[model samples]
Target: MILHLPAQKIPIQEIPIDKKVKLFIKREDLIHPEISGNKYWKLFFNINTYLAGNPEKPYIITFGGAFSNHIAAVSAVGNLAGISTLGMIRGEELKGKWRENPTLVFARRNGMNLQFVNREEYRHKEKLTEFLQSEFPDALIVPEGGTNKEAVEGIKMMLNDETKDFDYLCTAVGTGGTISGISEFCEENQKVIGFKAVMDNSLEETINKLTSKRNFSLIDSSFGGYGKIKDENIRFINDFKMNYGIPLEPIYTGKMMQKVFGMIEEGYFPENSKVLCFHTGGLQGIEGANLLLEKQNRNLII
Candidate 1:
């Protein structure tokens, strides 16, 4: 798969926590520039199993929003793996203009058949699943955000032997698959803190149902929910890049880092605690988001 990554640690310098506390990022974003971050791990096994179990079933289908990193990753990987991919995009208005959004444009370039639907219809993934089953029955359907048992199983690889001892593991939550997978494997002494990019509590139930471990908690850093950004979030993303030289997209990692800083200011962690964060990449979405921001007359996430 084009999604392969080796375990590597990168430090987060000058985190506001006391001198005793140390923070580092797992740097999953650096794995592959395109098929980067948690999406790569989330899709690695799903694609493999689909091909191995049903060789004749050459098609795979999945769901995503307008600028979803999951859609981008799946499309990029499918092209590499010789699989026909279909994307059930979330807005009917996006149907005709592929040039408007960078993510949609990339997916189309990679040979993905983009099917756009109304927001009301896209809310229920089961409806999309039913449609896929009826129209293309043999297609392997990966859930939105790639959060499925197979994706969770693949994500377990992100925490290997070297990263077993940290006191805490931090990551941004989208569909909750990445954190759920890490929660299962993180040792009893280590806790996982997931900062939700979306502002709903629905993901909590889904995550609880997926993993057996009680080692994780979700924190709100949505900045008014998924894909919607406010002034503070924009300032934080830009300042963070200027300070640390790491680019974070508004959808996920940016909110997560913001939450981490907020918690540290509140003295959330004990002195001498060790934390490692998984950088779930969505840097590709920046271009598309900036376009929307420009229209809103909001500050671009430069």
Candidate 2:
């Protein structure tokens, strides 16, 4: 199914976090069902490129965590496209059972084959290309998060039109593929900034390796770590919803907006400087985050 999302022009609103700066959101979160936001463009490119080769392969294989949106998208899209999908998950099976997490459940329901691996093996995912090739010789190997050359190229098409001159083009950085692709396409006049969702310095190196350009800036914006959401972040998420009617997940876009607000408060952005932020989709994960927060609140009350 072709992912269809309303590409409505998201308003450029003045920051309530600070009055001097302005923020514009690219509502990619509302892109589509299953293949939503960047995931759609990311996978769209990869699948097209794979078909370009005209290989005899009938399936695609990728890696991700238990609750990974990439896995979910791949499974959903692959099923609809009549292509098989294999998910190499990073973590042990749930205690006493193989099934665990909503993403995995949905992936299985969508007919994706799942294989769990240890943390160490998962960390060496890049090095396991040979192993993966040997296992699925006829399958195309997509990098985790679908962050690859084709994925980057597909996403760049969204930024082709100049709606307005932006001082900084920002987005949440995960595997650095999205930012790297954006940075590569950015002209000398525009600065590309990425907010790290995970609390790891290695992201800089990862991005550097992805692209040779120094025009990209990486900020350590993770409140604690990946999937680590604090009360302040929850408040920000709520405030964003109340003020702009935008639902931002704490793991990615919420942290990015949090940093943007911080930069505004610190007078990092000049007065009236336009900032375009990309809302990479993963809204489904919000349910998991809310459930965890509810349990935390309940424990505190007890």
Candidate 3:
């Protein structure tokens, strides 16, 4: 039951943007087909540290929304490690409709047991986590989005000598763990920028507590809302793929890249500043996103 997968040296490629600022992207998405990008790093120490304890009957339990990348990654880890997994999914209505969702279907195929809880119950995750810990004492219950101290520690692997040359480190912020890691471990002169995918008001404070240094800034990148893909977003994603030959999931990477482009255009970055954005992968959500677009007779992401 070895859970420690070797982390890869993900390539940093230049994004050909006609701006004074040199824009680059870290291809973290290419790390794994299933456990891609930041999710892989976030779960790295969480799973390995738990497995190192050598608990008998190892089981993993985690929480996520229907199309959550975290849920998909955790299920993949469970399958790879030969550990049983339980997913406490938000929106109890999905219980009857889980088969329709590509992410949920993938989790099911990976042998993850799905348990749906209502929105209210999901919002109060602390109580649910407490109960689940009691029920499955041996289970490693990862927090929603796998954000924890261990996750922050794992994200350090994303940064190295190749990354230190950049003046700014950028990434799409979901649970704040990824940016927290960058802020905590980044070079003293480097500034961290987090493109917020979800409009969580408490996110700044949450990130502050996660890191001792205050070297990061958050930008509103939620073009419409979390998981609500607009026509413009779809168009941008298609154009980006066509031009850059890089696939970005609409929920996180797509929105972040869009906002980053806007910032570049608006002269948000200083001249000659080297900005690097982490392409945190969640490409698995594309199928489900395209399905929703097809139903609405909207433009699908390429």
The candidate, 1 or 3, that scores higher on TM-score is 3
Best by TM-score: 3
Better of 1 and 2 by lDDT: 1
lDDT of 1 by residue, 1-302 (tens): 34544545533333443456787777778777788888888988888777777667678899998898999999988889878999999999988777889999999999999999899999998977997788877888899989999888888878877678678899998889998999987788898998888877798899998899888988887887677788898899999888777888888888888888777667798987787878888899999989989998989998
Which of the two candidates, 1 or 3, achieves a greater lDDT against the reference?
3
Q: For residues 1-302, write the lDDT of model 2, one tens digit per residue.
A: 23433466433444444476677887777666677677887887688667666668678899988778889899998788778889988885542344536677788889999888888988999777678889778788999988877777777755755633788899899888888778877777888899998877788887777777788888988888888878788888888788777778778888899898888788898898888888888887776666666877722100
What's model 2's lDDT at 22? Answer: 70
Ranking by lDDT: 3, 1, 2
TM-score-better candidate, 2 vs 3: 3
Query: Which one is best on lDDT?
Result: 3
* Reference-based lDDT, each prediction: 0.84, 0.78, 0.93
**Residue 151 alpha-carbon offset, candidate 2, angstroms:** 2.3
Look at candidate 2 and tell me the lDDT of residue 95. Answer: 27
**Number of clashes recorded per candidate:** 0, 0, 0
RMSD of 3: 1.1
Task: Residues 162-280, candidate 3: write the lDDT tens digits.
Answer: 99999999999988999999999999999999999998989999999899989999998888678889888999999999999999999999999999999899999999999999999
